[model samples]
Target: METALTLQRTRSLRWRWLWLTPPVLFAALIAGTAIGETSISMDTVLKVLANQLLGADYAVDRIDAGIIWNYRLSRAIVAASCGAGLALAGVVLQALLRNPLADPYLMGISAGASTGAVGVTVAGIGAGAFSLSAGAFAGAGLAFGLVVLLAQAAGGGSCNGRSAQASGAIILAGIAGSQLFNALTAFIIARSASAEQARSIMFWLLGNLSGVRWDDVVLAVPVSLAGLLVCLWHRRALDVFTFGADSAASMGIAVRPVRGILIACVALVTAVMVSMVGAIGFVGLVIPHAMRFIVGSRHTRLVPASALAGAVFLIGSDILSRILVPGQVLPIGVITSLIGAPTFALIMIRGMRAR
Candidate 1:
C-alpha cells in the first residue's frame, strides 16, 4: 500500500510539472522581454504585449512599446525557438547515435554554414545577389549532403543489420565533413577577407541576435514547432534507440528509414538555426544531458523537458549577454560557453561518480 501511494504521488508530481511548465516558460519569456538595457518593468512588458497581441488599449510609452514589440519580444521568441529546436535536435541525435556527447553540430551543419557565409562574404560567390543567411543555408545543405554521402560510402546506409557500425560510420563521416568545411571557411577567410570582413565574419560565427526580426521569428517558430512535432512523433522510436540499433530493429522498428528521417529533420532544424543566428553551441549538448538528469530517460518526458529548459536557458543567456558588460553586448555564444562549459564539467563529474 505504501509503495502504491509513493508511485501515485510521484506520478502526480510529474503531471504537476507538465501543468506548471508552460506558465514557467511564459514567465521566463516575459522576464526576458522586460530585462534589457533600459530595464522595462514587467507591467509595461505585459501592457505592450497585450496592446499589440490582443489589440488592447494600454497607454504605454511609445519608445518602450516599440522596443518591446519590435525588438525584444521578437528576439525573445526567436531565442526560445532556436533553443527548443537545438535541444530537440540534440535529444534526437544523442538517442539515435547512442552517444551522450552527440549534438546537432555533430553533423557538420554549423561548419557548412560558416563556410557558406564566408564564401558569400569573402569569396564573392554570390556577387552581391545572395544574402548571408541564404549562403549559410545552402552551405549547410551542401555539407550535410556530403556528410551523408560519406557516411553511406563508409557503410552507414547498410541498416539490414549492423546498426552500431552504421552509427559509428555516420559519426566519423560527420567529423570529416566538419573538418573539411571548417578548413574551407578558414581558407576563404584567410585568402580574400580583409580585416574588417574577417571581424564581421568572426563576430557572426560566434553567434549574434542583433539582426533578428519578425521575419526571423516567422522562420524560427514554424521550424521549431515542426521539428518538435516530428521528434515527438518519433518519441517511441527514440526511446527504443537508447538501446542498440539492433535492439531497436529486433523490436520491429524500421531502423534505417527512421534513422534517416530523424537525422534529416535534425539537419534541417540545425541548418535553419545556424543560418539565422550563427552557431550557438552547448545549448544542444548540455541541455539534453541536463534534462535527462531531471526527467529520467523516457523520451516522452525527456524531449519536452529538454526543449523548455533549452528555451529558458537561451533566453537567460541572451539576457546576460546584454547586461554582462556596460555598453557592450557579448556574443550569445560566448555567454553559453562560459556557462555550459562548467555545467557540462559538473555533469560529467556527476556521471562518473554515479558509475
Candidate 2:
C-alpha cells in the first residue's frame, strides 16, 4: 500500500513536471536564435520575435529581422519538427516491436533514405530539377514496405504468431536491408559525375542543416502533423500491446492492421525528416528511451513526454553543432550520436543491473 502511494506521488510529480515543457521549449527556441557567428542578445531576439508575432511597429535594432525570419527561424523549426517526428516514431516502434532498443533506423529507413538521396545525385535522376527529398521519400517508402512484408512473413501476418524470435528476425532483416542500401549508396557516391554533386551528397549524408530554408519546413510540417496525429490516436493501442499480443487481443485491440498503419505512419514521418535532415541518427532511439525511464511505459504520458524531450534534445544538439567550432559548424547528426551513444550505454547498463 505504501509502495502504491509512492507510485501515485511520483506520477503526480511527473504530471506537474510536464507542464514546464512548453515554456522550456519556447525558451530554447528563443535561445537558439541568440547564438551564431553574430551572437545577438536574448532581449533583442525576443523583441524581434514579439514584433513579428504581435505586428507591432516597434523596430528592433542590431539583429537582422530578415535573417532571423528567413534563415534562423526555418532552421529552428526544422530542428523542432525533426525532433518531434523522431521521438514519436521511436515510441511507436518500441511499443510495436516490444523492444526498448527498437528505433526507426532499426527498420532500415535511414539506409533506404541514404540510398534514394545518393541515387538522385549519382544518376541525375531529375537532372537539373530533381529534389533530394524526393529520392529520400522513395527510399524510405520502399524500406518501410519491405520491413512490413518481412515482419509479416515472419509472423504469418498476424500478432498471434509473433514471437520473441520475430523481433530478432525483423532486426536482422533491417540489418540486411541497411547493408544493401548502404552499398548501393556508396557505389553511387563513388562514381559521381561531378565533384560538386558528390560534395552535396556527402553533406546530406552528414546530416547538417546549414542551408535550411522556409520551404523545408513547409514540406516537413504537414507530414509531421499527420504522423503526430496517427501516433496520438494509437497511443492507447500501443500501451495495450505492451502487455503482449495475447493480452492486447484480450483487451480488444486489433493488432496486425493497427501495426501496419502505425509502421506506415512512422515511416512517412521519418522519411520526411530524414529527407530534410539527411538522417539524424539516434534521436528516435535516445529520446523515447529517456522518456520511458522517467515517465514509465504508459503511452498516454509517454507520447507527449517523448516529443518534448526530443525537441529539447535536438535543439540543444543544434546549438552545440553551431558552437562546437569557432568558424565551422559540425553536423547535428554527429552531435546526437556523440551524446546519444554514451547515454544509451549508461541506460543499458542500469537496465541490465535492474533486471
Candidate 3:
C-alpha cells in the first residue's frame, strides 16, 4: 500500500510537471537572452516579445531593441530549438531501440556532419554552392542511407523472434558508418591542415554558438515543431515497441515501418540541427531519461515533457557557457557533457537500486 501510494504521488507530480514545463522553459529562454554582458531586463524581454508576438509596436530604446531582437533573442531561439529537436530525437531513438543510452549521434549523423564540416574546411571544397552546412547535410544523408540499407537488408527492418534492440544490427551498422566517417574526417584533419583550421574543426565538433543568428532561429523553430509533432503523432507505435516485436506485431503494429519512420525523423531533425550548430550533445540523451522518472514511460507525456525540459536545460547550459568566462563563449557541448555525465551516473545508480 505504501509503495502504491508513493507511485501515485510520483504520477501526480509528473502530471504537474507536464503543465508547468512550458512556462519554466520559456522563462529560461527569456533568462538566457536577458542575462548577457549588456543585460536586458526581464521586462524588456517581455516587452519585445509582446510587441512582436502581438504586433503592438511597443516603444523601446533602439539600442536595447537591437540587442534583444537581433543578437541575444536569436541566439536563444536557436539554442532552444536545437535542444528541443535533439531531445525529441533522443526520445524516439531510446524508445525505438529500447536503449537508455541512445542519442542523436547513434545514427551516424554527428560523425557524418563532422566529417563533412572538416572536409569543407581542410580541403577548401564547396567553392560555389557547396557550403559547409550543405556538405554536412549531404554527408548526413549519405550516412543515413547507408545505415538504412545495411540495417534493413537483413534483420534490422523486421524482427524474427528477437527484439530490435537485442538484434544490435542497426546499432552495429550505425557504429560502422560513424567509424568510417570519423576516419575520413580524421584523415582530412591530419593531412595538410593548418593550426587555425584544426582549431576551427575542434570548435565545430565541440559546438560553438558564435555563428548562430536569425537564420538558425527561423529554420530550427519550424523543424523542431514538426519533429515534435511527428514524434507525438507516432507515440502509440513507440509505446507498442516497449512490448517487443512479437507483441507489437500481434497488436497490428508494423514494427519495421514504424521503426524506419521514427528513426528517419530523428535523423532528419538531427542532420538539420547539427549542420547548423554542430553536434550539440546530451540535450537528447539526458532530457528524455530524466523526464521519464517524472512523467513515466508514456511518450505522450514523455515527449512533451522532454521537449520543454530540453529547452530549459540547453538554454540554462548556454547561459552558463556564456557567463563561464569574461569574454569567451565556451563550447556548448562541453557544458552539456559536464552536466549530463553526472546526471547520467545518478540515474544509472537509481535504476540499479530500483532493480
Candidate 4:
C-alpha cells in the first residue's frame, strides 16, 4: 500500500515542473515586498531589488527603496529562512523519531521559547529583539536539556545504540517537559505581568514578523544555511532509519551519536527561528509531510523540496497576512495555522485512504 501510494504521488510531481519553485519563490518575495501599508508596485519592487541587491543602475524612489530594502526585504528574507529552518527541523525530528506527526515544537522547545520571550517582555529588560532572542534561546536549550536528561533517565537515548524503546522514552520525556514548562510559563505570567503585558506576550507568542529587519535576516541566513547543509550531509543516515536502527548500524552509521547531533542541531535551529518569528506553526508540520508525498520518502529529495516549498509557503503566507486585512497586519502565524490546519486535515484524509 505504501509503495503504491509513493508511486502514485511521484508520477504526479514531474521533475520538469519542479523548476517552478524558484520562480514562485521569487514572485512571492516580490509580492510580499511590495504589499504593505505603503503599497509599491511590482515594477518598483523589482527595480529597488535590482539596484540594492545587484548594484544595478535602475532608478528607485528613496521612500520606496527604504521600505523595500530595510523593512520588507528583511522581513521577507527572514520569513523564508524561518520557514525553511522550521521545516528542516521538523523533517529531522520526524525522521529521527520515526513518527510522521513529529515537529520541531513537540519537545517543548516552543513553550520554553515562549517562557523566555515572555520573561524578557515582562521583565522590562530592554525588551529588544536581541534580549528576547537571548531569553528564548536559553529557554529552548533548557527545555531540550531537560527532555534529554529525562530520556536518559528512562534509558531512552541512543547513547549506546538506537532502539524503539529509546524513541518512546524521548517522546514521553518531551511530553512531561512540555507540561511542566507550560505550567511554569503560566505561573511566570500570572506572578510577574500585568494584564496588558500578558496580552502582548500572548500576541508575540502567536508569532509576529512585524519587527523583523535586515539584522534578523543576517542572523537567520547563516544558521539556516548551516542547518540545511547538516541535514543534507546526514540525509543518507536519515534514509536508513526507516529500515530500523540496527539496519542503519549494519550499514556503518553510528545511529546513536548521529541522532543526538541531529536532534541538537534541529533544536537550536528551531529555537533561533522561533526567537525571531515567534512560534509560527504548520509550515514545519505540514510542508515536510506534503513534500514527502510529492518527492517520495528519500531524505535527499525530501530535505531540499521541504526547504524550498517551506520558504515559498511562509513567504506567501506573509503576503496573505498583509492583504488579509487592510492597514492592520495580522500575525503571520495565524495565517499559517489557517492554511496549515486545512492542509494537515487533507493529508490525513489522503493517508487514511492510502492505508
Best by lDDT: 1
Candidate 3, clashing residue pairs? none
Candidate 4: lDDT of 40?
A: 86
lDDT (Cα, tens digit) per residue for candidate 3, span 292-342: 888999988998988888888888888988888888889989999999989
Ranking by TM-score: 2, 1, 4, 3
TM-score comparison, 2 vs 4, better candidate: 2
> lDDT, candidate 3, residue 323?
87
**Residue 21 in candidate 2 has what lDDT?**
86
lDDT of 1 by residue, 1-355 (tens): 9999997887677657767778888987898899888888888989998998899998999999999989999999999998999899889988877767777566677788778877987899979999876787788779877976898887676322246677777778878988899889888988999989788777877888888999999899998999899988999999988887888988999988998888778877887888778889898889998987776788998888888888999999999999999888899999999999999999999999999
Candidate with maximal TM-score = 2
Candidate 1 accuracy as lDDT: 0.85
TM values, all candidates: 0.89, 0.91, 0.86, 0.86
User: For candidate 4, lDDT tens digit of each residue in 1-355?
Assistant: 9999987666666453356677888887877788877878989988988897689988778988999999998999898899899999888887877767667566677777776766676664444655766787778878878987898988787423366677777777877887787787788888889998777666766788888888898889888999999999999998987667787889999877887788778877877888787888777789988987777788878888888888989988988888889878888889999999999999999999999
Shift of residue 11 alpha carbon in model 2, Å: 1.0
Q: In model 4, what lDDT does residue 337 have? A: 92
Residue 157, model 1: lDDT of: 66
Model 2 lDDT per residue over 1-355, tens place: 9999998999998887679888888877776777765677677676777888887665776347766776777788788888988889888877877767678776688889878776775777677475877787788878766765776676634323256777666776677777777778878888764778777767777778878898998987777677778888988999887767777788888877887788778777887788778878888998887887788788888898888788878888888998889888888889999999999999889888989
Give stretches of model 4 more than 4 Å off: 1-14, 56-59, 120-134, 148-173, 194-196
Over 4 Å off, model 2: 61-63, 126-134, 148-161
